[model samples]
Target: MMRFHISYLACAAAIIGAALTAAPTAAAHQTTHQTRHQTTRLVFPGQSIQRAVDAAQPGDTVLVTPGTYRESVTVSTPGLTLRGTGRETVIEPGTTKAADSCAEHGNGICVLGTKDRDVEGVTVASLTVRNFTGTGVFAMATDGLTVRNVTAVNNGVWGIAQERSVRGLFVKNTARDNGDAGLFLANTIKEEAGAADTQGTVVEHNRLEGNRIGITVRRLRNLTVAENHLTGNCAGVFVVGDENKPRAGALTVRDNTVADNNKSCPATARLEALQGSGIVLTGTEDTLVTGNHVTGNAGTSSLSGGIVLFKSFVGTPGERNRITDNTLEGNAPADLVDTDTGHDNTFTGNACTASRPAGLC
Candidate 1:
């Protein structure tokens, strides 16, 4: 396995133009009016966030005040808005242990949708979620789910994870110091449980740092990851397919800044073996990687590059994946690496300082 030590000196000059502050807290909504079908529930620090969640009816708003609340919150109700009124509103693992099901799933705040009761149209915003055993925010099998303007830090696994959900939005969030991918979106297509693939999922304007992967998309469709700052991680962005499912298509990774992602973490052999790269596409199809600043993600091996297109045993072959219109520079070993199994993947109109598998530039 290739071990990595995190460093940002190489990309110091590169990151000058990037945003350096936390996501704007003032953008948080003060109060939202209840709809005809919904009501609003208010809670304070002493009252558990989950208490309001349980008491909430469909389309209800659960607004929390500014304070630290140590608890594991799960949302099973649909059309609910669980929002923090202030930036200081925090949710940490209070009595929840790693042995619990919520902690095992790495979900500090989980939105689980069942066949009888799907948690659709749920919004969670303007909160800090940290020190949880699992993902800071986890949503599954929901439609029209929105998570915005939140900070997720120092979690055990993925910072924000969404699976088997459609039409979801994740914006203006900061995710750092996580064990796995900072933002992970995966759709599990299982016959027994009626799990379906996700579509129209948007991730934008987020800062992802110091994680195994800045952002990860697996087996998703019609997804967009744009305008995000990805730095100081093991790998910047990874888009791959699950071996058991059909490959993901219609994906876009655009207009993002990815730099200096070189951190060490424990992983499966295949993941651990991969070199540091700004973006990696394994067994994906019909994907676009464009208009991004990819720089200074250089590892010791030839595998480290600005962008990588490769075939893996875990999924389908990478075909028709376009790598275009990007500024790629200062990557070690080579700027671009494409393995033999990658077929019909094009690299055109890319402005790069260096490249491998020659002639792609």
Candidate 2:
């Protein structure tokens, strides 16, 4: 592949400049008539946010006032809005952990839906959840689930996570200092299966730092990650897949600033040691990677690069993906590294300084 020295940064701006949909707040879910008698449940300091949430009806709003509350919250009802007074509302582990399934599972907040029924249209917004042994906010089997403006820090596995869900929107959130990926979206975490279509789930405008990976989109399809800031993680964004029947791909990573993700994380049971990786695609196909700014990420690990098309841990090769119109610089090893050959991957119209095998700048 012959490398071209073209700056499509200006052209990329014109193409990706269309404004996205205005994010809607949880309180705006109901119409005027439906909200005429909207119930408002309040939780004060020293009170339980969970108590208020449990007492609320489907359309009710559980609003927690500013204070530190040490308890895990579980929301099972549909169409409920759980809001806090911004960052002033803090939730951490309680002294004697709640015996509820959520707390027992080590999660800060749980939105539960059974396999037979999905909790629909529930929203969690504007709070801080930290110091949990498990996820900051976790959801399963939901539709139209929105988690916005939540600050998730220092969690064990994931900051904000979801599985077996659809049409979920995660925007304007901050996830930092997590043990694993700051934001994790997957078909299911418990088993190996074909990829699930997310029906256009969106992750946008979030800041991710100090995590194993900023965001991990695993075994899912039809999702979009855009306009996010990622730094201080071992890897910026990982689009991961394996030998599952329907390969994970058909997603978009666009218009994001990913820089200096040079934190060194030892290899996990399933993955290699990682550092300074910008956007990585493994065992996936037909993905569109465009209009991203990846800079100053440098490391010696095999996975390290500005943009990497790697064979999966299970040795599934990526195929037919487009790596285009990105801006990259100062990435050691290479600005673009394609580890698999004859896979029909294309690298075109990017402004970068170096590449591993010579022509993919």
Candidate 3:
């Protein structure tokens, strides 16, 4: 009787194993069907990148070869990838004016989606976009947009700019010598709006230098700026806010190297003269600044410091912000500063020598 019971148990185990194996087999068949439909279109030098992009369907990739192409690109399709061979695949301005709406707007590449719907699952990678009057790469109303391994240099405005986008990943890219921030994300650039929820957008593992600011997070929420190298800009990172509702905050700035942001920028119409700011946060709430290495940023500007909490221009003060666990040195005026009248702001566990109000280190 014991042998019969053991044999029955073995049979039950074999039945369960077979069922599990069969379920995966069916799933594999479905996955194969889905993967079979994705296509790749190649574009060479002297070819129209926009034409190839327009001809592509959803789940298509437009791969460009290593050459200099003088045209602008606009991508509106979901589940699309626009990848280049490497930095050798350069995009410059076209010969004539009004090449397209993107070129007409003075942008290198534009990923445009409507106000009502988001363009989802787009990827732009491995290219060099330079010398545009406007932004190198621009996006709006996008979901899950990934811009990786791209180089943006010497643009008149921002190197990489996005608005009304969520779930974005900007990684392993280089942005330098732009007029504005190397990477700029905002709720809206022209209009006044409340903060927009980014739904876990991440800017990580990039290098930003020689711009007005390294990275700017303006009026955004639920995002992270991490693990980037920022130098030679007027400011390393700027988390900007104003008197708008649903205020801009709830983001993380962590594990970055912010150094030597001492370039002088004249005052713009909306901003003060900028220099030597490592990480500046104004009019934010519930923000976390941690684990950063800030050094060699020295200037006498109003926003100058290793880490600062200055008064916002629009009368909204930072509240519930936490500055912790950072290493700061060689910053002028102070290594830490808090000049705003904010509530629930805390500074602890930082390795710094000087602070404006004292004891912040």
Error (Å) of candidate 3 at residue 57 is 0.7
Top-scoring candidate (lDDT): 3
Q: What is the lDDT of residue 326 in candidate 1?
A: 92
Estimate the overall C-alpha local distance difference test score of candidate 2.
0.87
Error of 3 at 223 (Å): 0.4
Model 3 worst lDDT run, 10 consecutive residues = 24-33
lDDT of candidate 1 over 1-361, digit per residue (tens): 0111012211221222232222212222222224466655545556667777887888787877668988888898888888875458898887635454665665789888986555779999988999887789988878899999889999988899988778999999999998788999887524322213566779999999998889988767788999999999988998876444456767899999999887755557556544467888877788999999998898864346789886755535777889999988887666788873757789899998677778877
TM-score of 2: 0.90
Q: Write one digit per residue (lDDT tens) for candidate 2, span 112-209.
A: 89999999999999999999999999999999999999999999989999999999999999999999999999999789998999999999999999
What tens-digit string does per-residue lDDT give for candidate 3 at 136-210? Answer: 999999999999999999999999999999999999999999999999999998899999999999999999999
Q: What is the TM-score of each candidate against the true structure?
A: 0.84, 0.90, 0.90
Residue 71 error, candidate 2, Å: 0.4
Model 1's C-alpha root-mean-square deviation from the true structure amounts to: 11.0
The weakest ten consecutive residues by lDDT in model 1 span 1-10
lDDT of each: 0.77, 0.87, 0.88
